[model samples]
Target: MNELPSRAHRPVRVLRVLASRHADSTRMVRPQDFDTELVAQAASVSDVDGHERYVPLCVDWRDARLLLSRWDDDCAMSDVPFLYQRQRRTATHLLAVPFEQLDAPGRAARMTPTFIFSIGRCGSTLLSRLLAAVGEQSVSEPDVLTSVAHFDDDAERAAAQGARERIVQSCVAAFEPACGPAPVIKLRARCNRAIDVFLNAMPHARYVFMCRDRDDWVRSSSRAFGDSGEALAELLKASVEAFDRMHAARVDPVLVWYEDLLADPVRALRRILLARDDLDARRAAVERALRTDAQEGSGLSRASLAMRTGDAGALAAFGARWREIRPERLLREHGLSRLR
Candidate 1:
């Protein structure tokens, strides 16, 4: 004879039980899939029907947009376990709405996001990963910003600013719900070229520029760039100069060095998090980032190895002509770097 369970006990038992559903693979998502409450966030620009269109990367948190970049096509049913923890649902197929279909009201309500721009082969990726440990949705090296930075004309750049803001607003609506109220985006290093143009669009956005020791950067970049190593160094130098100028002018930007991050990543990250006012979970996130191999699969690490071992290919790429570009006058004026 078995005792009858109470209503509460039955519900608990039911929750503990596992069941599977046969989701229809052929089911098409209609316009009804999205609405003002459920809007798509701009993940990337794609070609649809021979015209450039915005694609939804993830769903906004109000109803939860599927983060497309995190989804794997082979495992269509898989969801980011960290995300949608309560829902237990994964987006098997994505539904992208026209740019005009995105919820305008939602975009206006989103928080301003942070930006991370760095010299090539710096610790930008590692910083992004560390930020993720703290539950921040970090997008590392997005191509969209790089493309936006290519517009050189002042008028054209000004025009692009509006479009850029709209895209960012959509991205914020989509990613912030999952990453944090303020999502952090790490743009391609080249975006440094158009930093002002970008900042104009999102005037209040927080930004950080990462750099490395001159010798270290030169050695690392030379390995891959060959004859262009000097040019790469010049670019890095220019970026640092521009960043220093901004800092001197009272622009709210932070300058981070590769050496400092490597020596004490937790401390380094804490500085940025504190500056950004996102220090919640700093202790646990720093611990997790430090406990794990932060530089796993990092191309920068590989380049450093090549430089140390004196690989012939690396030597050839780096070439024999190593030139030390002058640090920006602003850096010297501000006493920013120890590199002489």
Candidate 2:
């Protein structure tokens, strides 16, 4: 029999090495856990604009598994899964695998994760939760993307490109299904201002822009924010502004109404997912989500908001500003031209 090739000459299994090293425990990050030379980088970052940034991350090439670590100064890592956290007290020899090293292109080549941009107080959380039930990965609110969206200057723009890869890695790490689509990233309402920034980075990425009907939106928002005049105005402005930017960027997003989704969750989800072949594979997961009752769990559901009659009054107060912004384009984009 021919002699086997020397281990040194053989292809290095990067992902397997990282996973095996860290399999024993989840504790302090270990340098040896990563093939640093392959792609040496840090996983720690400070909070950006009061939002927690993702800790440094990398991908293991051997098994193609993603890895991340809790940074000493990063508070955002506190809420992440226990494996990613640094448990200083325990005498565990947890090796921190550098997840940032493996920023290889097309890691999630089969599926392009969807982006869900919504008006606040809509049923986005519920929709995200439902998607999760159907084997879809959903990152509801992350700090890194928010910071990336605001990038305008040269340095910030370059940084946004790197940040985009890391964000994709984070989603890769969060994804658990053996063979499903990429994760859905649901942006906070505030990020609506920089929606184009994100779209520019992932040009082919599909998106869904969700909103409640004007009346329901005003009512729900007023209940959430008591002094609702300015806030309500901003909400409407952002909703319209997002569409304008989408049109300018030529980012065609499917518009979903909260009430319509509630009425028929299955069909609504299918309409959104069926937009792409990869997403269509999640049919079973969608079925499971349909059966799931909305409740106060996993930060997905909240007690239903009571309709506030004062919503009409609040809208009246912002009448001038509201009229100044043209909503006809948005109305037509979502097939609500009849409203226009």
Candidate 3:
């Protein structure tokens, strides 16, 4: 097995050093202030001619900066199971742009993008891959949006609301030149907390909500993460509440259940497609996508997750615990009686 790095050389410590330097100075970072080799690998935003190849990987909210990684092609981005993993593996040089300086012209007027929100373990990744296979520019789980979702400080988050919204808009716009006319973005499961920010940023965007049955979701989550039954129940509770808010919102989202999606994926695709003019042409692509594992090379792949021993007793306990914390009435109110 590969040995872990020493504590002093860990990523968290390195980030802390950078953050300390950033916090102390208002001026732009200089090569001498940090590791020369690392600085040499950083790119200036102005040096890049086009935005299409640069993807927003994450946000350093403390310093109010967004990190963009350069991707060589769409294949480099889409082939990976998740955008963050692609960044970790292939991003040799990065561009850090201040939130105030980031801009995408005509962003407000551009055709609204499509969003895929889910409670996870619910075929969202499969849907994303299927869309990509069909020639759609499907972006799966970009970290920047997740950062915004888990900003953590209420006062700071409230103060930076406008900047946060702009960052969200700019990040979406950055993908347009290559992924347009409408890029479909699949958000991380926890990202639903900031769903309002996305909705407010792009009022006209289409939304698709994906979810699975409560018992299956809890079981899958527990098995995938090896977490306790209680922990999984809490996550389920939070996720369902977020879904409830979105479902009751002014924008009507296309609701897809995992069972129904697996039953008839083409039907689900048809519902999500803005126009069915090319549905017939994309049918084979969808079938091909279904044949393959969407999370194949990622840590979350089925083969990788299968290495963990399943605990039947734990799953049974989760089912009993879920009943105690059940949102059955909430599901019924949102027309999710099927989930109940």
Query: Which candidate leads in TM-score?
Result: 3
lDDT tens per residue, model 2, 193-220:
7776566545567788788876666666
Q: Best to worst by TM-score, what's the order?
A: 3, 1, 2
Per-residue lDDT of 5-115 in model 3, one digit per residue for the tens? 122211111121131123222122222232212343223355455445677767766555667766764464656678766564555445666554566535744767888
lDDT scores of the candidates, listed in order: 0.50, 0.51, 0.68
TM-score of each model, in listed order:
0.58, 0.56, 0.81
- Which run of 10 residues does model 3 get worst, by summed lDDT? 8-17
With a 3 Å backbone cut-off (N, CA, C), the pairs that clash in candidate 2 are 15-62, 29-96, 30-96, 43-56, 57-99, 57-100, 58-99, 58-100, 134-285
Tens-digit per-residue lDDT, 1-340, candidate 1: 1111122211000011132132221112222332222223333323222111122332222222222222322421111212221112333334433334344535535566778888766777677777777656676654434545554357645444435545445554555434555667786666777666555555566788888776666666555344265466457666776686466546578778888877876677777677545555476766676566444433334443565432344333333332345554656765555543
lDDT for predicted candidate 3 compared with the true structure:
0.68
Top lDDT model:
3
